[model samples]
Target: MRHILVHLDSGERTAVRLALATELATRFGARVTALFAQSDRYGPGIVARRAGPALEEAAAAAKAAAEAACAAAGVACEWWQLLHGERNHVVAETVICARYADLAVFGQYDPAGDAPVPEDLVEQVILNSGRPVLVVPAAGSYATVGRRALVAWNGSREAARALGDSMPFLAGADAVTVLSLRGAVESSVAGRVPPVDIAAHLASHGVTAEVDLVPPNEAGVTNMILNRGADLASDLLVMGAYGNYGFPFGLRGSNTRNILREMTMPVLFAH
Candidate 1:
């Protein structure tokens, strides 16, 4: 919840992307690291001598711009020109793990090749780093973050992490709902520990919340979360973003990116 990492690619640092980062950083007194990862089209080019001095110069200029953005915001920053990797997930993984960023802030992924897949890289950061991600959309602004909120809670480690990290925003909300879906196979030795415990935890923090659970085989848990938020008329949706395992289990979840791409409402996600 403290260190917020921002991608300073394609001139996103000046738009609502950086504005949102400044907003959140100012609120929490957090440091911001604007990472400008070079697009992954250089290795083969260098092999063929296409990546010349011009490309290196451009990389240095990008570094300066990113630094100035952070300086203007009155926070410490680390600017990197990662010139040799995939444009998406590799950079996301590097900063969160290497930089120890508590949270990653990004604008919506408007990829030229595939849109949702790039955005899913953001989801991958949430899942892999076990940290929260605040994604500002292409057309949206930071104005969506305050006032009212919806928290989709399933009583899992992912949900708990999100709930814990989003306290600053949630405490600022109008109404909050800790919604739970999917069945729980619990031990017989203990009573059923419902997701309501989350609501109570939030209540102790002065954030008023309600508890709700959905049945098994419920289609579109993402939709349910949004609908419930709309029912309560919340502005922002806070929830645990579920992702499959990294290697052989890497699967872009339907409930996961479907919620991100289709959600008109903003989602605050943690793994």
Candidate 2:
């Protein structure tokens, strides 16, 4: 990726997100844009009046953290801020900013408290930006990523799109594994096209990958992905952001939601 846009927030996980973004930028010799989005909270006259200053302070702190981190990493970086009067406006601004980026990095939503971006911001950006998103978990520290990568494949349209979008990371990985759960593949096309075709495709792009067909198990697909990811010691997990229709705030399928909730490592998602 040439240009990366990272969502900046004054949350507990902001440092982790900034570290990951700067690492990626340094690795790819890319430019990093740190975006801090401030939103006005709905309240009465007095509460509303005080919200702006607090939000601005949080935004300024987040921007400073990002700037310092990027500078320490010696990466070319720029800062951008969006001041919106509403939550939806924050999401809209993020999506609009992502249009100029090659990849977008965001921290996993923290519902407990102290999150600058909306909880559903990642989902909105994935669906609307037409770009890949790399979500860093709220807990733990990731020192390396895209070194040992795991690709969750199911032969679906979303999975295929994710695979295509992750070519840059795949090509740079030391070892890549493509995992396909049994019964997840469509029967009609199972024999027509093999999973090896995916490896061959990546090979053309200079990515060497090994395919693993996982059998049906009690852990379910989402758990299987996490299990395999841990087993492989994968620093990065690549998967499709599957979503069900009719969701009000976010577009996320069960598996996608589960992974987002429990992931301990960075995940790259495309819808």
Clashes of 1: 1
TM per model?
0.75, 0.87
In order, candidate lDDTs are: 0.62, 0.79
Cα error, candidate 2, residue 264 (Å): 1.9
The local lDDT score (0 to 100) that residue 240 gets in candidate 2 is 82
Please identify model 1 stretches exceeding 4 Å from their true place: 11-14, 41-72, 85-99, 112-120, 144-146, 182-196, 213-217, 231-233, 243-252
Consecutive 10-residue window with the lowest summed lDDT within model 2: 243-252
List candidate 2 segments past 4 Å from native: 41-51, 189-196, 216-219, 243-252
What is candidate 1's lDDT per residue for 45-133, written digit by digit as tens? 53542333544565566567656656777877776545444545355645455236777776556664322224355655666766677
Q: After superposition, how far is residue 191 of candidate 2 from its true place, in Å?
A: 5.1
Task: Itemize residue pairs with steric clashes in candidate 1.
Answer: 147-174
Give the TM-score comparing model 1 with the true structure, all chains together: 0.75
